[model samples]
Target: MSMKNRHVLGEAVRHLILIILALYTLAPLLFLFVNAFKSNNEIIASPVALPEHWTLQYIKTAMEAINFGKALGLTFIITFFSILLLVIVSSFAAWAMVRSKTILSNIVFLCFTAAMLVPFQSLMYPLLSVFEKMGLKNVQGLILMYGGFGLSMSVFLYHGFIKSVPASLEEAAVLDGANLFQMFFKVVFPLLKGTTVTVIVLNGMWIWNDYLLPFLVIGNKTGSKTLTLELYFAKLTSGQYGNPWELIFPAVFVTIIPIIILYIFLQKYIVAGVSEGAVKM
Candidate 1:
C-alpha cells in the first residue's frame, strides 16, 4: 500500500480499538442506569434489553428507603473532611521532608514510600484493635484512618511535584519577610493547586465509595451511615432470600452521581497533576 494509505489504515485501526474500549468501559454503567429504571422482573428477564417503560418510581423509592439525604450528608462530610485533613497533613509533611534534605528526612520519606506497598488487609485488624481500644470507632476515627491510609500516596505525589517546583520562589517569599506558615501556605500551597485537586479527586472518590472502611468503623450505625453503608443496609432490608437488584441498582446510581460529577470537572487536573508530579520523579 502507498505510505499515505498505510498511515490512514493505522489511524482507522487505532480509532476502532479506542471505540471498542470505550464501549467496554461504559457498558456496565449503561446497564446500571437502565436497570435502575426497571423492575426486578424486567431486569431479570432481560438484563441487556432497554427497559420497556422508563420510570423514576424506583429511583424515588430508593432515595426514601436509603434515607438518601442523611446518608449523602454524612458521606459528604466524611469525604470532604478526610480529603481536607489528608491535603493539609500530607502536603506539610512532604514539604518539610523535601526541604530538610537530611538523612533522617530521607529515611522518613523512604518509609512513607514503602508504606504505599503495605497491604491494608494486614494492618486492618491491628488498626481496628488500636482504634477500638482508644474509642475511635466513629466518624472522627474514620477520617483519621483515611488520612493515615491515604497519607503515603498523597505524600509521594506531593514530594515529586515539590521537587519540580523551583526553590527560588519560596526563598524569595522568605526574603520578603514571610514567616514559615505564611511562606508554606501562601506560596507553596497555592502552587500545588493541580496536585491538591488531584489528591482530592483520587482520595475523595475512594472515601466516598468505600464500604469496607466505613463498615468496619461504624457498622450499621443509625445516624452515622455513609452512602455506601446506607446502600448495603437498604439492600439487606429490601429482601430476605434473594438479591434486590432493583433497589441495588437505583441506590448505587444515586450514590455514584456525585463522584461522577466530580471526576468530570477535575479529570483534566488529574492528568496534569500526575504528569507534572512524574516529571521530576
Candidate 2:
C-alpha cells in the first residue's frame, strides 16, 4: 500500500475504535432509559429489548414517591453554593500562597496539597461525628463540608494557574489603589476564569453525584436528602429478594437529567478550561 493509503487506514481504524468505545460507555444509559419505560415483568424478561410501549407511568410514580422536586432543588442549592464557595475561597487561598513569602503560607499550602491524598472514606466517620455533635447535618452543613473536602484539589489547580499569571497585573491594580479584596476579586479573579471554570465543573459534578458523604452526614430520612440519597431509600420497601426496576430506573433517569443538561451546556468551558490549565501547569 502507498503511504497515503496506510494513513487513511489508520484513521479509519481509530474512528472505528472511538465509535465502539462511545457505544460501550453509553450502553448502560441506553439500557436504563429503555427499562425506565418498561414494566417490571418486561424488564426482567427482556432486559435489553426496546419497550412495547413508551409510557410515563413509572416515571410519574417514581417522581411522586421520591418527592423529586424537593430533592432536586436541595441538590442544586448544595452544588451551586459549594462550587461558588470553593472557587472563591480556593482562589484567594491559592493567590495568597503564591504571593506571600511567609514560611507559614508555604506550610499551609503544602498541607492543603497533601490533603488531596486523604481518602474521604477514612475521615468519613470522624467528620460525621463532628458534624453530628455540632448539629451540622443539613444542606448548609453539607455545602460547607463539600467546600472543605473540595478545597485541596481546587487550591492545587488555582495555585498552578496563579503561578503562570504575571505579578505585574496585580501590582498595577495596587498602584490604582485596589485593596486586598478588590485586587483579588477584580484583577486576579477575572484572570483566573479558565481555572475557575475548571474548578466549578470538576467540583460541581462530584458534589452533585456524591452519595456516601451526604448519606453519612445527613441521613436519607431528612428533608434535606439529596437526589442520590433519595434513590438509596427508594429501594428500601422493595423487599429482600427482588429489585424495583420500574421505580428505580425512572428515578435514576430523573436524577441524572440536571447533571446531563449541565454538562451539555458547560462542556465547552470544561474543555477550554482544562486545556488552559494544562498549559499553565
Candidate 3:
C-alpha cells in the first residue's frame, strides 16, 4: 500500500480503538456516579437509566461513618510531613551521590537502590516489633515509617533530576562564601522543584490512599485511623441492607477527592516526571 493509504488506515484503527476504550473506562464511572444516587430498586430495574431522585443521604452517611474530616486531616498530616522529609532528605542524598565523589557515597546510593526493592510486607514484623518496643503504634509512627519507605524511591527520582542540573550553581555559591547548607537550600534545592513536585504527587497518593500498612501497624486505634482504613471499615459495615448509599458513595468520593484535586493541578509535572524516569530506566 502507498504510505498515505497506510497512514490513513492506521489513524482510522487508532481512533476506533480509542473510542472503544474510552467508553469501557468512562461508562463504569458514569454508572457509579449515577447509581450511587439511585435507589436499589432503580439500580435493579434499569442499570443505565438516570436516578429518579438524586440523594445526598449516602454522602452524608459515608462522611459520618468514616468521620471524613478527621480522616482527611489525618491523611494530610501523614502525607504532608512524609513527603516533606522525603524531598528534603532524598534530594540532598541524591545530589551528594552524584556530585560528592566518594566510595561511601556510591555505597550509600547502592544501599538506597537495594532498599527500594525491599517490599513492605517483608518488613512488617520487624517494623511492628520496633514500633511496639518504642510505643509508636500510632499516626506518628506510621508517618515515620512511610517517610523511611518513601525515601528510597524519592532519592531515586532526585538522582535522575540532579544529573541534569548544572553543578556550577553550587560552585558559584561556594565561591560566594556560601556554606553547604546555604548552597543546598537556597541554590540547588530551588532547582529541584519539579522533581520535588513529582515526588509529592507520587508519594502523596501512595500514603494517602494506603490501607494495609496503616491498618496493620496501628490497628484502628480510635484517634488515628487514616482515610483508607476508615473507608474500608465503613464499606464493610455499610454492606448490609443495600449498602446505605447515604454513606457508601460519599465515602468512595471522599477517599478519592484529594487525589483528583492534586492530579488536576500537577498533571503536567507528573507526566514529565514519570516519563523521564521511565525513559532513564
Best by lDDT: 1
lDDT of 2 by residue, 114-166 (tens): 99999988998898888888999877788899999999998888887888888
RMSD of each: 1.5, 2.2, 2.4
By TM-score, the best candidate is 1
Q: After superposition, how far is residue 39 of candidate 3 from its true place, in Å?
A: 2.8
Error of 1 at 180 (Å): 0.5
Query: Between the candidate structures 1 and 3, which one is better when assessed by TM-score?
Result: 1
Instruction: Supply every candidate's count of residue pairs whose N, Cα or C atoms clash at under 3 angstroms.
Output: 0, 0, 6
Residue 128 of model 2 has an lDDT of 86
**TM-score for candidate 2:** 0.93
As for TM-score, the candidate ahead, 1 or 2, is 1
Please provide, for model 1 over 94-192, each residue's C-alpha lDDT reduced to its tens digit, 9 standing for 90 to 100.
Answer: 999999999999999999999999999999999999999999999999999999999999999999999977889999999999999999999999999
- Compute the lDDT of residue 191 as modeled in candidate 3: 78
lDDT, residue 83, model 2? 94
Give a tens-digit lDDT track for model 3, residues 107-200.
9888998998888889889889999899988877888888899998888888877777788888899999999899989998887777778899
Between 2 and 3, whose lDDT is larger? 2
